[model samples]
Target: MHLLKIHGSGDARLDDYQRPEAGPNDVIVKMKNCGICGSDLTYIKIGGIPTPGTITALGHEGSGEIMEVGSAVDGINVGDRVIVNPMQTPSNIGSGGPEGAFTEELLVREARLGMSILPIPAGIPYEIAAMCEPLAVAMHGVNRAELKAGDKAVVFGCGPIGLGMVLWLVDRGIDVVALDLAAERRERALALGAQAALDPTQIDLRAELAKLHGEVPSYGRVGVGTDAFIDAAGAPNILSEVVAIAKYHSRMVITAAHMKPIEFPAGRMLTSEMTITTAMGYPTEMPDVIAAMPRLQDKIASMISHRLPLSQVLDGLKIAATPESCKVMINIDEE
Candidate 1:
């Protein structure tokens, strides 16, 4: 079998690897499609995600069919289609480590198979099912924010995750103000049902929020009061900027893992009594996300800009980094 291996910075190659036999309580899946996450590019260029220099096998967000099941495995058969959750341990298949879904086949432990190896809903396409991982992440962020009906929010990015945020928010009856630096992304956000999509670089963010939601008078200062401020963009100055326009007693969920230390003035947060929290990895949110796949199928489909086979994995990475693309998927099943 051929697998994608990341050796060093800006270095990746397809290497021949031996197939593995499922243990007594394991499941082996034939790879179908895996999306190239933003972090995947980061791992290829730099090194390490959870730990430094840990990228061995690449590609995590994927879906496949069960080609084999161990003797001890029950309730799962050889023909079951499954979506592999990469957040599991790397020692097993679909693990969110160096050993991921970039290969032709994967070995996953049955003990960790509950939410980790979700059976793809019948009739859902492999490419759509492959998106469950990222969509799950987006759903988890919304779950963390605890948004209420009719509440308004400003999403700080319009990438895949940010766009996913919009879809979830809109489906829940929340009005969203999608903010991004790129015009194309802003347009995409608007098309995704964002009440307003503004490029922060060109507009006054605070003033625009004021227009969407009425002004809030706090301690002789006036600003817009929004229900939540979700930052999906890992930009350097976004934290401080969001703090400036945040509503009093509002919730600010940091979905993006900012690589650098960002300065946040405690004075600003204290005055507003705002709750600033962060969300990591989706837990127990895959089911709801999968159910909504049919409703969001079209929008989710638009997020994918390019779909290439494993042989062109490196090229897919390059397109993902460009401004022209939103999401890139690698077809591992294509031989």
Candidate 2:
């Protein structure tokens, strides 16, 4: 079978791999559309992800059809459209596993399967179904924030995750502001329903928030500081900005992992009484993320700025890093 493998550090190409066995406990999918996650770019350029592993199949966010289902995998049948959740660790004693997410024909654990399956309601499309994973990721951040209706939310970063966060927050009737350095992203965020979008590099976030809410007549609402601040930006200092804009008792959720050690101000956190939580991608939130798809609309699929055949995988990765592109989708099933 043809699969996408990293040709070398900073590259990717089609490689013939042994076919996956259709075992009773296993499920096999014919690749369809897969998004090039930022993590995939890191692995290709940096040789691999933070963890060590020889380049194997690469691609995590994808939607496809069930060509065959193992006998043990009941309720699943051929022609059943599905999306594979690429992240998981097989349950076992002292099991420790973490690695890459890029692949064509994905084999996922039955228990770790996500909301990628069909039965997509009246308006949902297969491309959108492929997006449940990232939406679920943003949902994890929102879930951690403990957001409520009418609350204000600021999502930092206009990357796919950040945009998804904004869409989710807005769908819940919460007023939101999306912050990013890219003007295009800021525009996209607003289009996704953020009441306002600002380029933090050009606008003072503190001042902008105060302007929108007017004077906080009373300080004890506990809802101050945006009810919740989501740092979708991977930059470390951006996390501090999330903390800075948070009201007393408001929570700050870090959705992206930092590549460096960021200096955090101990004094402000202690004085403001703000709570902080970091969201790690896991199997826990996939269902709710998938269930919320109807509200996300086409904003999820619209994020796909470019689509290329799998033979051009490396070129696709490069496009994802550019400011002009949003989400780059790789047509892995294509020659």
Candidate 3:
């Protein structure tokens, strides 16, 4: 088998790997599709994951067919299509594990149903099924926001995860205003059912939010009535800017991985009584995300802006690093 791995700074290459064997309690999946995430670029730029490891495999958002099932495993069989939950795996497969989905096959040790893997509905395409991982991350962010129907949200970023936030929010009947500097991303957000998509640089975001979500009056001051805000943009000033203008009692969820220390205006935030939280890997959101995939297939499909075969994953990573693309998928089964 062949897989992509990072050796050192700015060094990611395809190398031969031994084919995995399924133990009595393990399974081997034939990888079909995997999406290149922004973090993959970061890893390549700075060598492997920060953890103490000489080499690290790359790829997490993926889906595949059960090529080999464990003799002891139940409810999962060969030929069953499934999406992996990397976090549930013993070694966090892909990020810095012994196995990565960017390979011909992946070994799932101690595989179990609805935990290490979940069934992909028959109709969902493998490329879209590959998105389940990131969508689950987005769903975790949405769950953190504690949003309700008829509420309003402003998603700060129209990248894959941010766009996923838009889709999930819209499906829950929330009015969403997605912000991105890229016109293409903004347009994509609108296509995913956000009530409005605006470039924050091109508009008065607070004023626009006020008009779209109505205005909230609190302690002789007015703020946008949006009930929640999601920071998927990772901009240095996004947190401060949101804290400066967030409505009273509203919520903010930070899903973006900011590399640098950001300024958090505690004084400004205190006045609003707003709650701020952070979401990382999905805890219990993958099941719901998978269940929603069938109904949201069309919307999810629009998020994919580019596709490349596994052999061209390096180029795919370059494309994903640019603003022109969203959800660059590696068709592992191709070429």
Candidate 4:
């Protein structure tokens, strides 16, 4: 088998490895697709997984077909199309773990029916099923916002995860206005059923949200009535901007990973009683995303902007790091 591994800083290579066999409670899967995440590039930039001189395989978001099932594993059979929950594995399958999904075949240790592996819901393609991980992350962020049906939301980015947030919100009948610096991303958000998409550089976001969602006045300050603000852009100014214009009791959820520390305007946020929270990985949202995939297939499928084979995964990483790409996937099995 071949796997993509990071040796040191800026050094990523596809190397040969021994094929893994299923253990008593394990399963071996023929990887079909793996999505390149922004963190993958970060892993390369910082020299390996955690330190300057370490080694680890390089993928997490993946979907595949079970090739060999352990005798002890029940209800999961060979040839089952499934998406992996990396976090549930004995060693988190990727992100510095002993195992990674960017390979010809993956060994899922102690595989459980719904915890370690989930069957891809029918009607969702492999490419889209590969997105279940990231979409789950996005859904976790949306869940943090605690949005209601009639509430309005403004997503501050339109990349893969951001667009996923838009799709999830729209599917639940929430009116959403997505903002991005790239026109193409804005268009993608619109195509995914966002009520409106705007380029933040060209318009006053506060005024624009007020127009779309209405305006509220409190403590002699006017704020947009948008109920939830999700910061998926990770821009330094986004936190302050949301604090400045958020309506009373509005919620702000930070889904993007920021490299540097951001200054929070605690004094300003107090005036509106605005709540700010952060979301990390998906905890219990993966199953929900998989369940929703069938109904939201078209919109979710549109999030993938590029696909490359496992042999060209290094090139795929470069494309994925650029703004021009939404979700760059490695078609490992050409399925």
Tens-digit lDDT track of model 2 for 1-335: 56666645765666666664656777777767777777766766665443444454567777777777777876777787666665542521011122123345655545223333433445676567767777778888888889899888788888888888888898889999888888888888888899998877887667788777543422443224467788888776876765555667777888786878887876666546788889867457776766767866577777777888777877887889987778887776676
Give per-model TM-scores: 0.94, 0.87, 0.97, 0.97
2 or 3, which is superior by TM-score? 3
Residue 68 lDDT, candidate 3, scale 0-100: 91
Off by more than 4 A, model 1: 49-55, 89-98, 111-113
Candidates ranked by TM-score = 3, 4, 1, 2
Write model 1 residue lDDT over 220-328, tens digit each, in one string.
6665878898989888888888788776788889999787899988888766788899987787888888888877788888778789998888788888887667778
Q: Could you tally the backbone clashes for each prediction?
A: 0, 10, 0, 1
Which residue runs of candidate 4 sit more than 4 Å off their true CA positions?
none
Looking at model 2, which ten-residue stretch has the lowest summed lDDT? 91-100
Per-residue lDDT of 241-322 in model 3, one digit per residue for the tens? Answer: 8887888999999999898999989988766899999999889998898888888898899999998998898888878989
lDDT of each: 0.81, 0.69, 0.89, 0.90
Stretches off by above 4 angstroms in model 3 are none
Q: How accurate is candidate 2 locally (lDDT)?
A: 0.69
Clashing pairs in 1: none
Clashing pairs in 4: 9-47
| Residue 102, model 2, lDDT | 36
